[model samples]
Target: MNAHPDTPPASLPLFLHDSVADAVALSAVDSLAPLLGIAVKEAEKVVLKANECAAGFTVREILCTNETREILRELVKLLASYAVTKTGMATCMTRTPTLDPDALRKRFDDVREGMRLHELLDGEQIAAVQELFAKAEIAPIRFDTTPVIATRRRGLESKLQERYGDYVRVAVVDSAATAQALLREAYPVLLVADADEIVLDEPGIISIPEHAVADDSIVYPEFVVQSFRAKSAAIAAFVQLVTEFDERKTSSLLDKISIPDLEAVLALLAELARDESAHKVNLADTVLSWEEAINQEARFIAQTGGGADDFKAYLDEAVISMADELQLAGEDRDLLLESAYENLERGPPFEFSRAHTIRLQEHYARRIAEQRYFRLRDYATRLIPYEEAVNTALKRLFYLDFLFAVARFSHEFGLTIPEISSDGLGVIKGRNLFLVDEELKGGETVVPISYSVGSTDLGIFGATPLPVAILTGANSGGKTCLLITLATSMILTELGLPVPAERAEIPLLPLYLYRRKMIKKTGSFEYSMRALSRIFMREGPKVVLIDELEALTEPGAMGRIMAALLNHLPASTRAVMITHLIHELRPHIDLKKIRVDGIESEGLDATGNFIVDRQPLFNHIGSSTPELVITKLMSRVRKAKLRAVYREILQALEKERDAWP
Candidate 1:
């Protein structure tokens, strides 16, 4: 089955298990997660889940593996040389604010009712009212609502007037004609209609829709107010993150992210960008308040003395210039100048009679502040419709980071996506990652080895594939390294990550690596047997790797035990055991039932070192060649008697070699 589009793939398991490391004699520091460059906690969680999945031998469909590989490949190609580590995927996961629809609905109702009753709005309510006006693209103004009474209009006007008092005028009219009369008188009448619509296309007449009136008063739509009010703290954070990503991303990088959820986020960001462009406003252009503007002007005036030319320059640069930009009405400008003059006279003294200039500056400052305030407010109000979209965009960014990390890991390792097979395992030109640059005592470079088990279709081993095999070799001919290479390939394949191989085909199965242990205690052999038994008894097909199992017991007994175990193993299971007792094992088990592969050591080179091929040869048993070791040691010794003794031993072994298998 295909995975859900919304669900992110499990983290790529890049780290080798400790058992695998020990079995292969790898250094303790080969972990892949830290190298992945994953920044957020969410990405870390994916890695953790992937590790768990690998341990459990969880099987995923070939379709899912192929799909994941495609995503990684595209990411690698698009993000080539664009290192995520350069900017450092900083922790961007933050708590998002939540909106309660019920609370917002109630707030709208309460504020509308308070406005209709001519009740002075509290600080919070006033802010809400201003927000509503901004969203509706209207300037906020004080106004009162009055009902049109058809009958018993007796004490109605008096009762309404008494309730509203001098704060607002309440004129109870008998018809729309009377309301029109009020509008004609320049009273700025807000006409509210119930069943009968009283539409008026006049500037002063605020026409309330028939459906928007409740109890003969205008009530703005609750849903519209709710939408505006729901621009919570989370939306602001999402905007900041989106902006950052946009600034760093190239068009090519963006084009490569075609995952459904990520595409949805990018699309929403585009919509938000369009909205911002349509209603662009710069909050930095506005001062906090008129008072703050006046203070700033005062400071500048104080710095430059009261010379007429200086004052004129100040007025042109700071006052008239801004007044022309804001387009303040002549009447409003005159009124604000008059108020400033009055305040100046009653306030602190200046160094000179700069009162007139100061008043003009204050007027322009207040007008500019008002203009900028409304612009910013409108911009914020317009974005409320995208609160939920912004939240989703932020959430998907974390998943994007996870994918990017996977891509970087794949690119860095030169890994290949393996084919998932129903049975058996194979790897072509596989190099053990841990041994890539490690300095060996022989000063030899790591050699890539190709091997196959359990399936003839892979074409590495001849006509028939060996499901169970004994791996034999010279003392240090990379027997353990071959096992680790296979284990790494299997684990990486299971986790849906590219393996460190040119090509690989792996079956999904639980992995067991048994490393050699030098425990010579009395019960060590029994303990080893019990551990091996438990692994075999587990009720599932699995891949097992054993390194020098003969170390746990006598060579004769170990060979016999392994031969019996190999013969009894389920046909579906695949196992490889590294042992020096293959010769002894050959006598106890049928060669047809169990195959023996060898890493052969050719005779000494001119440098007096054994030339060994690390890749195992299929269906071949290799000699340990202790005589070659003795000859090398003999050349290093200068004592005549010891060298002569080695010569005699070598001659005796040469005679015995002819009688060997």
Candidate 2:
């Protein structure tokens, strides 16, 4: 069940801050100890795929990006506490190379020349991979360190080039690459301080002189160090956004600040926070407060007293109004308001008012988010100056002939870094939180083409959008790869990494991979089925990707099992499935089909086998007005086909339903 080590994957490293976030993450894992024990009772080959990458950074490095290290340590400790019969750790990383001195000057010049107006590419590739060792934490996994080292060095080359090389050439020629070079070294270190690993190495893979390799041919145009054109443009856009903000223009979205609403909300919160418990249990006091509350609409709290509904009703309306002020319209906005209301009803400590609770929670969540956001924003901001620096790095990389190699450096991790979001990634990976993609590498095919195979969207609108997708697609039709790509892509996206695609937007991560093969030893059809079932049934608030959902057994039985899965799947994850039971579970399948087109019956000839005369079809399902109602550009392409494809698809689905298993 091991995947090819060299598969290409673009992943965002997990941040395992060495503090509070880590404590929370570890505590969450500790919560699963009992559950994990139940799973390992009969299973074997226990694999704990943790955020080992974070562990890769030397402890000396300032660890504390969302408290990763302590969380990782706690996870390992908990796993050890589990007393699993057997277990191991594994990770996949892209190989990165490094360079130096005399090698430096040549790389500098090449990157400079390529950035000239027309040429843009990854700098000359002087690729090398190092031993990215994942030291034994309590002992399970080992990460690939060499690749990280290589990439890190490659990143730093620009800075080295600029400080010792030429700034004029860096600025005038290929600016993007020049910018990239300056940041490369620093980025890896950011990982060291922020993440669980350093898959990209420092001075490991850098742009050198194209002369070192050959001509501009060796490096890609995008990697050209002198490509300053785009950076200048981005600066303009940044300036525009700032100017608009300063000018109080609508485009600036400054209205979002809502000072008036904020004040109203704070006042409401203060009024609600009143210690109504001290007010009274006496009928006269109740009457007085009730009368006052009705007129003034003040929030009253009684720890075990009365008036729950009265307060809930009024607070609900207030929260709704606050949401409206924030411009949260439609369902999403409504849902947010409802959530705020529900949170209020649950009430905070007796000291805080329902309004105050909601306000504080809102503020705190925003604070936490803002804190996280600022960290990333800071990183991005620092990156701008480097865009200024790529020019020089490109020249160095070109001279060293490592351009193209450098551009793809960010994604060099041979293994797709699973963007595991909810809970620490270790839980999903070890506890069999169902996952689809592992060896999947549709790469280019999956992206630009938007080909999804056996893909199922498990999002529930009233609930969690994207439910578990139970996929069904023909073999060799890119079914497996599609599932893998989606599973990993979603994980990556959720984790906040730009996945390998034309463009991808998804949830965050601590991606876990569960191979169907691992559960095989559980033996019986029902036993393995239940074992797989157990994986999803464990603690949730996590996404599940199940491949060959039916391969566990009989079609009729599988249909029933799948039906149960569709119905019982955790409301947390948006699951997608890949199965051949498309026809069997057509009734249960609430997903669209992404199939290969060009199946000309004429082309089938004697074999009746499809001979692809054209590209694959990217067809989504459950998309009529309801689908249309839910869209905002994400489903643009799918929505466009709705006018024509909608009814036909509906009719086909109706017909297919009649023949379901």
Candidate 3:
């Protein structure tokens, strides 16, 4: 299926690149990567990073909604039934070039001529031509020909036959009269060319410019030189390797039917062309040479006398025998044999007539230029559909991974998507998401807190949602944890994921969490204040959580500062501020605008531990009692009776303490 048009944009609204990294690190979200079961690279691609926030949120929404998530889960199950993650898509159907096969064959012949010319040059010269092509940004070909080296046509033909005797054929039909005479021969000697000197009107007789041999040798063309150089270095290296190995070992590698190994070699060659290195000069030429070499081998078999039909079989046997001698086995030996035969497949037919060869080379030059132009066009247009198909599949797969991760996370934490509310938030038994795993591991129960500030219903008369909450409590009484729980739930809800709560009614808004530890250790209070000021300047609906705002200064002084700062805060944002200076700042806060809440602690539990209710109480500034410390120390007493005595004393003292503030 195609990606939806509404797929979230990739850009993030906040800190962009660096912010995600910080969030992932500080929030310990990377621990979820393994649970997703995607490739690390793919996981990184989909992780909740700032740059990918939009897409991630979109995906989160898709997976969070119960209906869409169920459909996606079923699709994944169907894919699992197939026993494969993805299907291979075909790139192209035809093996032959489509731009006029006949003309292309002719062009290919010209290129083959260039390949032959390459065999004449030394390695150093081949290297030079390759460099020239790369710098000139031309097709990697050395098409220039050297002047004819032999005066007599027979002499050059004989040399070509001798050097490439396996596939080379020499036909010396001097004139139209001579060509007619060859028509009577058992083997069909098709007249490939008709020259001005001897115009032959005959079936299978193509035209040419001249028949007589020239005195000077034709220089090898530059196109052929460049193309060959692309692969000459690699071929030369392999050849050198062959020479270095003992005969048996060499046979083992070549004669074995190691398809994977053979494919790996081809893959390596393809990769070489993709390299940013200078040797990338060989990109197209490497494949061309392989094709041209096979064509030439097929020609040798066709033109040679005696057992022409058995030539390929004979060649395969010879190569396999060599492989067997080197101790290659089974598929390895078969692989080598198959490779040898396949490379011998006739690629393109062409006559070696001098005039015809020259004319074809010129045609080849023009074809290469056209091919280059069209290749760019094909890449731009043709590649996109395939890229989109693959990308869509990837997104689908990642969606599945996200579903799996969320399913697991929900089960582990007993999470649920909270109902979207028109007012502020109310969470029942909320737990800190980050600490859930740790607490579970330690066999310590996570204390769940029920909290609320805003109104959840619309009254006929009027209803005012509580937009601000001030939390005050004793030290180590889970005050910070409650704030984190609220902030974390909001963050998760905004991402379209479930929250760690029994039940909740939360408004969807941009969430901003500020903690003292989030500030760099080197940063001063003024730096933090400036950062906070900058955030408040932005205009948007936000849920802001401030933890330990009193850490900026002494509680008394910080209380007044917080009061002044609260006056300037945008009314658009719903804020929860956790502070120790609540008593000092109470008069400054207009009670009508903000709500006061506190976590109350009873005297002590049976173990003499502080019995914090872990539930926020409305309209109360709870006592931060030091008596709980005395009870905790009493629990460590060797004598149980002594602990009970201390607990009773503490309870009595608490009763007489006369509630402070």
Q: Which residue pairs collide in model 1, if any?
A: none
Residue 291 miss distance in model 2 (angstroms): 99
lDDT per model, in order?
0.49, 0.32, 0.47
Candidate 3 lDDT by residue in tens digits, 550-620 = 66667888888887766556765577787767767876876666877777787677756677877776666
Give the residue spans of candidate 3 off by over 4 A.
1-391, 457-465, 519-523, 625-627, 630-661
lDDT of 2 by residue, 239-289 (tens): 232233333232211223333332333233233325223321232242234
How do the residues 1-661 of candidate 1 rate in per-residue lDDT, one tens digit apiece?
Answer: 0132123323321111221222111110111123222333433333333433433322222112322233233333333232222111221111111122333234234323322322333456434433332232111122222222221144444543333233335455566676567654533454543436545454344444433322111221222222223322223333333343333243222233223433344444456447547544322243224335555566677687654455445544544444444454575445434433444444333222245435444545434433333343344345434434443443333323323444444555556676776678888888775565252334446789988888735577442476887887778788878887887676555444567788888876666666664223324877667767855566767777777777776789888998888777765888888887876787788666567787777767888898788888877765566766887889788999999999999888656533434
- Provide the lowest-lDDT 10-residue window in model 3: 87-96
lDDT of 2 at 242: 29
TM-score, one value per model: 0.48, 0.29, 0.44
Measured by TM-score, how close is model 1 to the native structure? 0.48
Stretches > 4 Å off in candidate 2:
1-406, 410-448, 451-468, 491-498, 509-523, 586-609, 612-661
